[model samples]
Target: MGPFVRRYAMPLTFLGLFAAVWMVQALVLPPDARRAVIAWASTNLENLAVNPVGTMVASAFVAEGAQGVLLVVAAIGLFPVTRRFGNLRAVVLVAASHVLGTLISQGIALVRLQAGLLSESIRTIPDVGPSYVLCAALVAAFLYGHGRVRRLLALAGWCALVPVLLDGLLALEVAAVGHLVAMLAGGLIGGLLLLLERRRVAVPEKMAAEPVAGA
Candidate 1:
């Protein structure tokens, strides 16, 4: 039990936090107050401009849709990545992807708004969710998960998420664009981490071999 908890600490903590936030959103807050909380936590253009770090970090923990399904998907996606790469790397991969995805997507929206393409109302469109982080984890796990079962779980998650994530991609919707970018970012970051891990392992093996050869 101890080892199991240590191994899955990152995913377990994230899920716990997610559930707490879900409860607050669903049960504690009234509808009007819930909207206010979500708006405050959202990574919308106005919020991002005012408080980028807070909104980006807060947004990933707030769900805008079916929380139950998202929770399942998050568990499937996050655990494999954490088990494969350890907690720090898993967090880095997902968090970096989330921030990068948000920035790029919102940057595009800003450009469009400036060019008179998007409505002024987009500045406060209330974009909050865990989808970006979950998408990144799914991509990383699918590409680099250790076991067949882990990889299959990630594949299943991707299939379930693709329709929803890519729904308005052609129209360049903010959330859709963010999810796509987060997936790509996750894959790229995963490749880099894998390379670094291989090099770290190789160096130790090389050092050990050099001592044997000299003896």
Candidate 2:
């Protein structure tokens, strides 16, 4: 148990936090209050302008729809990435993807609004959810997961998520754009991490082999 916890601490902690927030949203808050909280936490343009970092970070932890299903999807995506990259790198990969996805999608919305292509209401549209993070993790894991089981889990996750995340991508809908960006960003970052990991291992092996070669 201890070894497992240490190995998968990032995913475990994330799921725990997600579960707690889900419980609060579902059980503790009434409909009105829940809506209020979700709005406040959303990464909408209004909130992003006022408090970018807070909203961006908060929005990733708050989600809607079927909680159990989301949790399972999150677990399937996150665990493989964490196991392959370790906790810190996995967190960096997902968090960076989330932030990039949100900023790019919202930035485009802002540009369209300014150019009269989008409505003013988009500034306050509720956009809170963990979909970006999950999308990113799924991409990274699918591309770079260590073994067959982990890779299959990621593939399954992608299949389940693609319809939901890519629904409005052609229309440049904010959520869909964000999810797409997150997936691309995650794949790129994961590739970089893989290269770095290989280089690190190669360097040490080369150094160790030098003495033997000289002898």
Candidate 3:
């Protein structure tokens, strides 16, 4: 691979795919058609309860307006995180964050609905976005962030994005909590993966240094 591609393959691949889907939604489809498509593909409580697997994948690609663009931009900026932790670890962390975040938030909403704390309308409320994955990636980046300045910058970026993700609405306050849970989950998972990788590497090294049983 070329130097540029080697350095940025992850972000470029993700951004290209996301931009293609987002552009089709923005330019090709009419507003009503787009909304219908979004509704059908959303990971809201009702939709998720019905179609958990597909919506988890679909919903990550359904950002609205500038959201999709910003997600790609952020992905590019944080692409180093992929390099730092290795692509598999980064992808797993992000995927887990998105899936777990959605499940946790919707689970809480279900409980509230059952207790009459939230409106039944929440079951069908539109909940598609790249926010969960992005939030998780950001948290993982923070964990891998090296210097004091890098860590502070990662944290500042997260704080700035949280209100936008939750839309600053009082009713959706639980979402902020859900995002926090996802971030913490990402950090924990990232740490564990790193620990496991270290142990895996150490085991072979220790065996190589030890004398053979018969030799």
Q: Of 1 and 3, which scores higher on TM-score?
A: 1
**Candidate 3: misplaced stretches above 4 Å?**
1-10, 76-78, 145-153, 166-174
Candidate 3, 66-157: lDDT as tens digits: 76556654563357567667666777877888888888888878888899998878888777776777777677777775566656666777
Candidate 1 regions with alpha-carbon error over 4 angstroms: 211-215
Q: List the residue pairs that clash in candidate 3.
A: none
lDDT string, candidate 1, 139-190, tens digits: 9999999999889989988998799899999999999999999999999999
Which 10-residue window in model 3 sums to the lowest lDDT? Answer: 168-177
lDDT of each: 0.92, 0.93, 0.74
Work out candidate 1's RMSD over C-alphas. 1.3
Residue 140 CA displacement from its true place in model 3, Å: 0.7
Tell me the TM-score of model 3.
0.85
Count of backbone collisions within predicted model 1: 0
- Per-model TM-score on C-alpha atoms: 0.96, 0.96, 0.85
Clashing pairs in 2: none
